[model samples]
Each structure stands twice: as C-alpha cells, then as structure tokens.
Target chain A: MKEKPVLRVTSKLLIPPIMLFALYVQFHGDFGPGGGFQAGVIFASAFILYALIFGVDVARRIVPAWVSRAGLSIGVLLYAGTGVAALFGGGNFLDYSVLAHDALHGQHLGINVIEFGVGTTVAAAMVTIFFTFASQSPHDPEDLRDEDDDADFDDDFDDDLDDLIASRTMSQGLSQAGGAGGREAR
Target chain B: MELAVVIGMLFFMAAIALAIIWVRNLFAVTMLMGIYSLTAAALYVALDAVDVAFTEAAVGAGISTVLMLATLSLTKAEEKPFRSIQHPVSLAVVLVTGGVLIYGTLDMPAYGDPDAPIHQHVAPRYVQDSGQEVGPPNIVTSILASYRGYDTMGEVTVIFTAAAGVLMLIGRGRSGPGRRRKTWDYEDLEGDER
Candidate 1:
C-alpha cells in the first residue's frame, strides 16, 4: 500500500481536506448533519488514513500517544469542570444559565465547549484503539502464540491457497499484496 | 417514495446480513459490515435523522470497519468452519424473543405520530422554546448540550473512561523503536501461568 506513487501523492493531498471536513463537522454540528461523535471519528479516520499511507511511526510522531492519553482525561475534565463551574455560579449541576451574565450566551458557550470535550475524548479513544490494534510487535513469539491459539489451524493447506485467492480479489485496489515489507496487512 | 427506498434498503440489509453470515472470510465479513453500516446510514438519512446518519457513517462505517480490520490483522482472517449443528434450545430462545419483539411492536405507536408518548413529553417545549431559550438554532444541540448538559458531560466522561480503560489494558504509551510495550503488549514472554 505504501509503495504506490499515486496512493502516496493522493493520500498526502487528501489528508488535509479530510481533516478540514472533520473540523467542519465538529464546529458546524449544531447547524448541520455533524457533531462531536461524528467529527471525532472522522478526525481519527483521517489520522488512520495518514498512518495507512505514510506509516504508523510517522503518524505517531505527529499525534503522540502521550498527547492522546492526556486528551482522554482533559476532554472529560473540561466537560465536567464546566458543570462544576456552573454550579459554583449559583445554578444547579450542569446549569449553564449562571455561567454567563445572560442565559443565551451561557448556553452558546456551554454547548460549544462541552461538544469540544466530547470531540476530544471520542477522537482520542478512536486513535488509541487504532494504534493498539494495528501495531503488533512482530518479533514476539508469545504474542504470535496468542494469535495462533485464537485461530484454529485449517487441516487442509489448500485453504491457504483459497484464502490467498480471496485476499487477492478483496485487495484489488490495495495492490501491494505480495512482498509487503515491515508493515502489517491493514 | 420514502417507503420504496426504505423497503429497498431493508432488502439490501437482509441480503448483506445473509452474506455476512455465509462468508467465512473475516476480511470479506468486515467489508460487508462496512456496506451494512453505509446502508444503515443512508436509511437514517431517509428517515431525516441526519445526526444519527452522521454518527453511523463515521463510527459504524468508518472507525468500526478499520478497527475490525486491525483486529483481523492481529488475529486470523479465516473463521473456523462450523462443525456443530444448530442448537434447538438457542433456536427456541431466539424464536421466542423475536415473537415477543414483534408482538410488542403491535402495541407501538406509528412512526412520526404527533401524539405519541415520546412527543407528549417535554420534547415539545425543547422544540418550541430552544430557539429563544437557547441561542442555538439546532434544538437537538440545545437539548443535548444546554438543556441536558449533565447528561452530555456524563457521555463525555464515559468516552474518557473507555479511552482510559483501553489505555490501561493495551495502550502502548510513548513507544519508540527500542521502547518496550505497555500492559496491552500481548507479549507474555514470562508465559505466566494463568
């Protein structure tokens, strides 16, 4: 998948717009068919695409596992802290009315910030899931055994042949089927 | 026209389900699941639940398929052939549950019924007053964020907890080329006895 020039060029070109769309979905959620959950997933998907095209290590350097880990909590704290802030301002728990001078302004501020929190957590969760699942340490024999245990070995070797053909057909667009080096099959 | 599209989508969904069940190849199954999600999202759009459609498209179609593929890469792509016959007890349970669900649907109000139990609730107030009460023109956002801010906050917390759980279980935090993996390393080199 990484070898093809067309794929690399197009994916590099495509990454920004996808990210921009995700942002649009994040902020324009109130007015259109978009929201934090959707935006977050879209954002993660764009990163995943970048990882797919560029490399996991490259993408990791950009996003950083630590940053996402911080995001996981920071997003939640932001949302919860907003509520506590409102409560301290002489309103009930999560009551946005007292957060600002007026109710309308408070609602606007509250929704945007809370939605941002949701977006952050969701995006971080998604990327974390991808990183954990996709990047397996290849040299580990014990981890290999874990996979072997889960996978029931087919007695017939021809099944592998069939699987090969099936995979070839399935991975038509993804032309780098054979001789794929260092990277796992996505 | 809406009814026709709904019917078509449902048929496609049923066919996709059957194909998914029939396909022993996990990779093919994952692709079918993506198609299923896309179909479901389209159906949501037809129903005018654009927010739901968006979520379905992003979460179900986009993220879920990628996750499944990732899992498949980690594990095996071929499912073991079924050696056992269908269990009568399980079949009986499924039948009973399906029958009960269908029977329950009989007592349910028609779709888009204005006087439905849900519509009778404070949804009306949210719909009517959201524009004035909350500055947001989108009532759903107003209700989700402003009106039920605590619930939204809780939802964010749940997502955060999920991320934390994943991190605790399998997060490879700050792993470089030489860095050893974390708890989710899947590398039980010690072969610690269970």
Candidate 2:
C-alpha cells in the first residue's frame, strides 16, 4: 500500500479535508445536524483511510495506543463531570441551566463541553477498536500463549480493571454484556 | 421530488439486496452491503433525517465496510454453499414475520403527519420550548445533548465498553513492560510475501 505513489498522493490530498469536515461536524453540531457521535466516527474514518493507504503501524505511531486509551477515559469523565458540576451548582443531575449566572449561557456552555467529551470518546473508541482488529494476525496462534505470560502483573491487572469498570458503566447493561460475551467466545 | 428520490433509492436498495443474495463471493457481498448502506443514507437525507443520514454514511458505509473488509482478509473470500436453500419452516417464518411487520405499519401515521401520536407526545414541547430551555437552534442537538443528556452519555459509554472489549480479546498488549511480543508484524512478514 505504501508503495503506490498515486494512492499516497491522493490520500494525502483527501485526508486533511476529511479531518476538517469532521471538526466542522463536531463543533457546528449545536447549530447543524451532526454532533459528537457522527463527528467522532467521521474523524476515525480519516485515520482509517490513512491506515489503509500508508499502513496501520504508521498511523498507530502518530496516535498511539495509550493516547487512545486516555482519550476514551477522558471523554467519559468530561461528560459525567459536567453532570456532577451541574449538581454542585445546586441543580439536579445533568441539569445545565444552573451552571452559570445566566440559564441560557449555562446551557450553551454545558452542551459544548459535553459534546466535545462525546466526540473525543467516540473517536478514541473507534481508533482503539480499529487498531486492535487491524493489528491481529489473520491466523491467530498467540491467543493461548499470551494469556499465560504476566511480567507487568500490576500494570496489566490495573489496565484490565480500568477497562472492565469503564465498560460496565458505559454498556447498556444486559444487551452489551451478551454481545461482549459472544465476542469473547470467538 | 423527495418521494421520487426515496422511491428510486428503495428500488436501488432492493436490487442490491437481491444481488447480495445471489452473489457467492463474500467480497462482492461486502461491497454490495456498502452500496446498500450508501443508498439508505441517501434515503435518510430525502426523508429529512440528516443526522441519521450522517451517521449511516459514516458508520454504515464507511467504518463498517472497512471492518467487514478487514474481517474478510482473515477469512475465506467465498461463502460456503448452503446444503439447501428451501426449507418450508424457514419460508413460513419469513412470510409470517414480514406479514406481521406490514400489518403493523398499516396502523401507523402517514409520513410527517403533524397529528401522529409521536408528534403529539413530548415532541411538541421539545420543538416549541427547547430554544428557550436548551438554547440550541438545532432541536435535535438540544434534545440529545441537554434534554436527554444521560442517554447520550450512556450511549458513549457503550461505545467505549465495546472498544475496550475488542482490545482485551484481540489487541496485542502495548509494547512496554509485560508486553506480549507478536510472532511477526503483518508489515514485516506479509507485506513482501504478498
């Protein structure tokens, strides 16, 4: 893929605009049709396109795994934290009107912050999933061997714990668990 | 004009579905599915559901198609030959389900009917007063981001969880302490071989 000059040039030309459009969708969502979810996916699509053309490894180096993992957590925290901020403002949970001196201003501010959070999480999640899938061997034999090794025992355990807690809260409860279970079986 | 576009896209989608059913090549089926999603996205735009259209275009036509292609690279390109296509029980089930669905649509309101039950519900308040309440001109955004913030947050979390699960299952450990090494990087092993 990296050897193709035409593809490299064309993708290089297209990627920037695709990314710009994604940002437009993310920020202008309040006045336009798109919001975080759409924006995030669009943003990920740009990276996916890059990966397709240049290579997944190259793209991963630019974004990296930990950066994606952090983005995932940060986005959720930003959204939930906004709600908590509302609570501290002497309003009910997720009530944005009390965030500022002016109700409309508070609503606007809260919506922007939350939408940003949503966009970040959605984009990171897509990238992480893509990287995970793309990185796997087509004929996987390491599944058994990898499970047995435990050198960074504390780090792996903590990472697994973080992912589990995040997933539990984020999941739609019963249905998501069932889907995750099915994936695990595979 | 919108009706004409909708009808054309519906026919196009049906043709794509029929082609998908007839195609034995799994690769072709995946491509046809992407086309189907693109058509559906266009149909959503014609129906004035731009938000939904945007999502379908990005997710259905873009990411999912790429994912399916990635999955295909890991599996056989040809679908397995079915032992038999005709089963009386399966046919009966399909016919019954389709009939039930069509019958259910018969009781629904016409497209964009102001008096529809859904329109009569809390939709009116959201449409009329959301400007004052949530302060966003886009009613959809206001409803999603403010009026129903919790649901959106939960949806985000669901996506987050799904990605985490995928990473846990198939993702190589990050290259650091306790890292599990790959037998070979796809680039190094498969690139030159191909």
Candidate 3:
C-alpha cells in the first residue's frame, strides 16, 4: 500500500501562532497595522494550508459544507444586523453612537461586531470554494464502459460469422454425398 | 530613517507589482498580486491610513485571491496564444500612467511630515474628540461607525451585493442536485452484475 502524506509537525506548530495573530489583529485594530479583514484572511489561510496538506475531504469533515454556508450568511447578517440595531435605536442606519447612550462604547461594539462578520464571511467563502473544487471526482466511468462494448461487439460478430460458415460447408458436403448415392442406385 | 525605510518598502512593492504583471501563470500572478496588496497595506500603515490598509489587506490579499482562483478553476489557467502586437501599446500606457503618478507625488507632502496639511486638518479634531464625543478608543471605528455611519451602511450593502454577484457567478445553483442524481445512478449501475 502507498503511504499518504501526513500534515507536518511544523505546520501544526505554525497554526497556533497564526490563530493568535488573527485574534491580535481582531482585538488590536486600534493600535496596530492589522484588523478584521487581514486577520480573517490569515485565519482562513491556516485552514487552507491544513486542507492542502491533509486533503480537502479531511478539511470538509472538520468544517462541513452547510456550516460554511451558514457562516457566510451569518457573517453578512451579523454585519447588517448592527446597522439594523442602529436604525431601531432612533438614528440613521448603522449609527453606532446610538447603540449605547455612551456613543463611544457603541462605536466600539459596532466595529467589533461588523469586523467579526467580515471575518466569518471571508473565512467561510474561502473554505467553501476549496471544498467544491476538491470534492469533484475526476473520471466518468460510463465513457469507459461504452468504449469496451464497441470493442466487444466487433469481436463477437467476427467469431459468429466464422462458426456459421463452417456449419454451412459441412451441411453442403453431406447433401452432395446423399445425391451421389441416389444417382448410383438409379 | 523612516524615510529610508519607506523608500525601500516602495521599491519592494514596485518589484512585487511588476512580478505580478509579468508572471505567465494566472494563479502565480494572483499570488504575487496578494503579496503586492500586502506590501501596499504595509505602506498604508506607514502613512497612518490604518483603516484603508486593513480593508486592502483583507479584500485584496484574501478575498480577491480566492475569487480569482475560483474563477481560474472555472476557466483555463493559461492565456490563449494571440498574434497581435498589443504588448507595446500596453507597456506605453503603463509607463505613461506611472509617470503621471510619480509627477503628482513629487508635489505632495514629504512622507509623514507632522506639519503636512493633512495632519493640520479636521483629522486632529476626530482623533482628539472621538474619545470624548463618540466614546470609542479606536477613533477610526468611532468615526466610521458613528459620524459616518450611513457611509458604512452603504459599504456593507456593497459587500452584500458583491457576495450576491459571486454566489450567482460561482454557485452550483439548481444544477447541483441534478449532478448528485447522475452520480447516484452511476453508483447503482456499478453495483449491478457485469
């Protein structure tokens, strides 16, 4: 049996740090160069790497198709939901100041929520694409069968014609002998 | 020291951009483009446009690459051979654009000079009063979500629209279920005695 390539120890070790960096970017958007979108990609890339190494089937098993779909929808909804919340708070749509009586706190909460939504949607979409491509089976077996049948038909037809010709020649010889006997008696 | 670093970064960014344009393989070009976007984001950070950088890094490096790969998967990765001499025209246009941009930049403020008109503008008010008025530690967040809340809403809507477009373009739609039926039929046939 052929051995399958396993996920390397280095990749496994790298995942934790990448995940931590994603969190750092998510929470530390104010002070640092990173934020929700970059962080989200980095987060997704970790999983993508895993999928590349272990195969798409294993990755799909970890993050199922339906779940990724839900994640995509949920992320958009979560981002949109923040805006709706602002609308209900008696301000124009997405006015985070209205989210709390203290407008600054509202802004913080709103950005956080929307960032999370963006992250989720981006990650899920990436995984979903990988799944769809990787899951497709390569060969169509029916085409092979059709070709086999054509070959078999040609072989069978040739053999059957040969058998029929042999039988006909034998019967004709027997009939000729009988006729010869009858003529001799006369 | 910072100016030297910025110039070095710009050179790196230009190299990446050139590499992306020159790469023959679409997938390789996409990857290089992601690197180019990241480098651009880093430049944005040096310029203190953190929010824009963040968005660029995410959309450009992450979503754009995925979308490109998805598109590549649906089409042939290689460009079809063309007998046209369009390369010279493309190079001329690119060079002209680059010249104009460089000429425009020469008149702009030196990189990150504190007394630059940008630093003296209403941005100071936002940076200072955002904590007091909007109550967010991240002033950009405060401004984006509060003072310019309607714009953010519009942006989100745009994202939704793009996602919808992507779903329409790449989605399996009604054909997925039909494909499953074919697969199942094939399986059933395979199970029968040959």
For A28-78, candidate 2 gives per-residue lDDT tens digits of 999999999999999988887777665566677789889999999999999
Which ranges in model 1 have alpha carbons more than 4 Å from their true place?
A138-186, B173-194
**In model 3, what lDDT does residue A127 have?**
63
DockQ category of candidate 3? incorrect
Position A130, candidate 1: lDDT = 78
* Winner of 2 and 3 under TM-score: 2
TM-score of each model, in listed order: 0.83, 0.82, 0.66
User: Which is better, 1 or 2, measured by DockQ?
Assistant: 1
Candidate 1 chain A minimal-lDDT segment of 10 residues:
A173-182
Candidate scoring better on lDDT of 2 and 3 = 2
Of models 1 and 3, which has the larger lDDT?
A: 1
Q: Ranking under TM-score, best-scoring first?
A: 1, 2, 3
In angstroms, the error of model 2 at B149 is: 0.6
lDDT tens digits, residue span A20-106, model 1: 999998899888767777888888888887766654555677988888888888888888888898889998877787878998888
* Cα-based lDDT at residue B173, candidate 2: 68
Candidate 2 docking category? acceptable
